[model samples]
Target: MACQVQLILAIFAALLAALPFLSLNSFPIRRLLYPTCRCFPGEPCWPSDESWDAFNKTLGGKLIKTVPIGAVCHTNQSFVPYDAAACAELQAHWNEADTHVSSPSSITAPFFADQSCDPFAPPSSPCSIGTYVQYTVRAAGASDYRATIEFAKSNNIRLTIRNSAHDYFGKVTGAGAIAIWTHHLKDINVFDYASKHYTGKAAKVGAGVSMSEISQALKQQGLLAVIGNAPTVGVAGGYTQGAGHGMIASRHGLAADQVLEWEVVTAGGELLTASPSKNQDLYWALSGGGGGTYGIVLSMTVKAHPDEPTATAFLQFNSEGISTDLFYETIATYLHNTLAITDAGVGSIFQLSSAYFAVVPILGLGKTKEKIDELVQPTIDALTSKNIPFSYESTQYNSFHDAYAATTVETPVAFGQLGGRLPPRSDIEFSTTSFTGALRTIAEKGGLISGLSFNVSRMPDVPNSVLPGWRRSTISLVTGLIWNNTDWNANLEAQRIISEEFIPEIDRVSQQAPSSYMNEAAAREPNWKSVFFGDNYPELLRIKKKYDPSGLFWARTAVGSDTWVEGSDKRLCRT
Candidate 1:
């Protein structure tokens, strides 16, 4: 009788232990009966298997597959379904979370970087209730593009296109939705160069091609294009959308300014070409309308320049004895002289430090010290006159491509997979401030100064072609602060205080300045629409509404969020 009682107790404990799993699978009866799960508000509601099957058939090919909603919710890493066992394991993990049952057909999965920790959707906050759905699509080529857009419209699903996934604001991918990964659309086509009105030699490149690949291709052709310093940044998507500027921008203008034409898929699902001649409205919009706002760009035809001999100089200066006033005066003089030499096709970037400053000036000249000096001397003279202690070195290369390859630091792409690596170890935060002469006083007061400024004077003189907020001036200056202390909260607070206090001071000086470069604009600004688009905001809004009538693309700091009201020109957050 004792042995029998012990056996009965053991059986009862085992049964009790299994109860949670049983209820987990059965309480949400939808999970057992349906193949997909949808979450509304907070609960997991299951969708019928038949609906999922029907949706899969519409995707053509085996490209669209279903995974248990439970599998996705629990995994911390990027969830790419490769097999059933993995899917089951993922589902079991996901079952522990508050997930809804929804068919994969109607769902769009958000692609995340490897180290991301934020829940895919924004919490219910003062702004809007973020949505999370579970369908993902990787579309490439013309046919896939059409099908993807059509399916999205038919199902009222939200879609986001991701290539290198390098967007700083997490705009490239999202949660609980379909993601159209375009990394496979890597094609480089050199059309009839002369027919495209190429005075020298230019090429039409696909959206998926990266700067590194394009740089190599152009090198083979003895040609070069204005590309960003980072090799991994996508040429068509990154460069075109951000109004890409580079070391050569002062000589050739912005990457977008060189665009001859662009093949884009509009909100209406039509593949169309835009240029100065065709779809003029879109041409203006795409020039610097910011990414994924108007439409998906398929390809771009941009101006190319012949490879020319070039020289690069690197100078370092210790700000040890420099007063804040002296530093500001010196910088002001440097800007004045730099602008005066704009016609010489001289471009220089100054990286400041709290205790030091590094200047990398690229001169478009032959491999001769005299030519290089002639290009760089004015700004160098200003620094020397200020009695600023500094060291200088120079090197000449066969071409600008070679010079860039040798001098420009390569930013690591994999770091992006690690929760978007923090900006260089500087105390500065980006701000959209017009440069005025306030630096003279700041320099006298011994304030810290560090940042970069690029001259875009060589950009083609296209009417209304400047960046929206940049209409006030010919030269744009980017100034920042460097914090030497590691008090995280205090440093952050200092950065905010510096940005808020000083940027407005600078902008007050350069009241008539050019538009802010979208790449450098503060992500916290509420009036980013006016700050980025300038006069083009109304048109962008119209196009956005046309393509995303349901406003599915709305996300934090995205192109079409309501936070960017028309004329709210004040900074949004303090930190």
Candidate 2:
């Protein structure tokens, strides 16, 4: 009897473990019996042609069926004749971010798109939609947002939200899913904003507004708001929702901190405003809880400050004349002075490798070029005294926009997986040995260490739900493995190293238990709930459940996403 009982228990345990995977096969029967799984293309419950037509009509013909951008190269897949010239042009500009952002369905990260469509492939090769969203709604306003949410909910289809498509962590693309593309909602309204709590100049920017557009609009009004390094990044989307940090973060605060109000469309298709005094929980959740989870934000009203003079610095050095050890040592010296640099209200974006070091640009709000040079003097002196060949430049501009234009360097997209940690001040101040060792190990592994350093210790005590680590962190350190799209085995190993090896090296020595910025964190990060939100995750989850009770929103690492699982077919189903 005991032997029989043991066998039964083992069998039961195996079945329980296999439950999530069971739905992958015979999905039609399983879905019919349970009716709990999300509907996808070719499924019995998927929306029919008439249903899609009706929905499109409601939006005044705004619905779009995705045609993979690379389809132009595949005659069988493309609607039009294959044009070799167009295919060549697409291949040439594939890495440029603007190429993807301009399209309704193309996301900047092609890895997430699963390479189902590749312009580089021979014309005879297959070109399927793969992981790209099957259909997109060019949401022009609130009514469109509401209708899309209602349709998604009633149809039991996986819904995705995308703006600018600048996602690094695969949050925007979903296979066999429908997405609301907010890239065309470009309305920027600047005014003298006044409320019961405070009064000032603010801009109510539409969800589609990019950093470049908003900066230009605000500059025209002789004002500025916190913006990210990428000008193409949307102002009211994932950037701010993930607690935006930028070149002036130390001078102001996070972009989330600048938000005064959010106009959103909820999961239930109701339009509402979220702010400190109204829908308080929704306000907190939307501020930094990560986008596409809480609601579909239509626009955000953010505090704008008067334009100011700005200075910037650029520095670069390579290992041509210096030893690798000496190069890292120079990097260490620079890292050691991060606290002082940020304290002086300077913010910077820098990169490191075993063979080179570069500070793309450092912003000094209201500071002159002389002051900028003084702030970097210690690192310059260290390089000079050690006879390290280097190039450095500091320039002052009449306005912050001019400085931004001069310093901004466009970056490529969809190249690799990203993993990072927000290293608290203690790591640089007290636990210097372990911190330095971690960075060295990463660089030795060919991981690019991109550091965005700033001081947020002075951020006002507010109720937003950003990673608590942000306030205590001095630098956000990101390192990752770059992989060519065709290598599955190599890509798997790269993901494992970044999630399991590279990030852990930094986590082990972090004295304050620092977390990661959700927007740039690794896709498979361990203990992601804690790594992304820390102590605030529980509350964020509670708010997610309350607002989206049926679990209408799901992203890879967004709040409360563990309940759903993606199968081999790339379909999202309830676990």
Give per-residue CA lDDT, model 2, range 1-575, as digits (tens): 98986786566456646885543224343344437567878865677899899999999999999988988877667555788999989888887889999888887766687767777666877788889888999999999988988888767778999999988767788987889998888899988888776589999999999999999998888899999889999999999998999999999999998899999888888888998888989999989889889889999999999889999999999977888778877887888777788999889888987778899888998899999898888899999999999999988899999988888866787677778899888898887767888988898988888999999877554579888899889998889878665675787788889988899889888886659898888878768899889999999999999889988888888998989988998888788
Q: Return the TM-score for candidate 2, rounded to 2 decimals.
A: 0.92
Write the residue-wise lDDT of candidate 1 on 1-575 in tens digits. Answer: 98986786566456647776543223234333222322222233322356446655666642444243323322333344234464455434332211211222211122222112222212221111122224545556656666666655544344666666555444554433455556556777654454333455677888878777787888877788888766666788845766776666667777877788888886677888987777877776677667676678888887777788888777676657878556645555555555544446656666544455567655553446567666667767877777787777788788767787787664422111101001111111111111314544343333434333345644354432345443223343444433322133544554464456545555554424324566554434445665666676777777677665655443344456663221221111111
lDDT of 2: 0.85
Off by over 4 Å in 2: 1-34, 75-80
Best by TM-score: 2
| Model 2 CA lDDT for position 139 | 92
**Candidate 1 local distance difference test against the native:** 0.53
lDDT of 2 at 131: 90
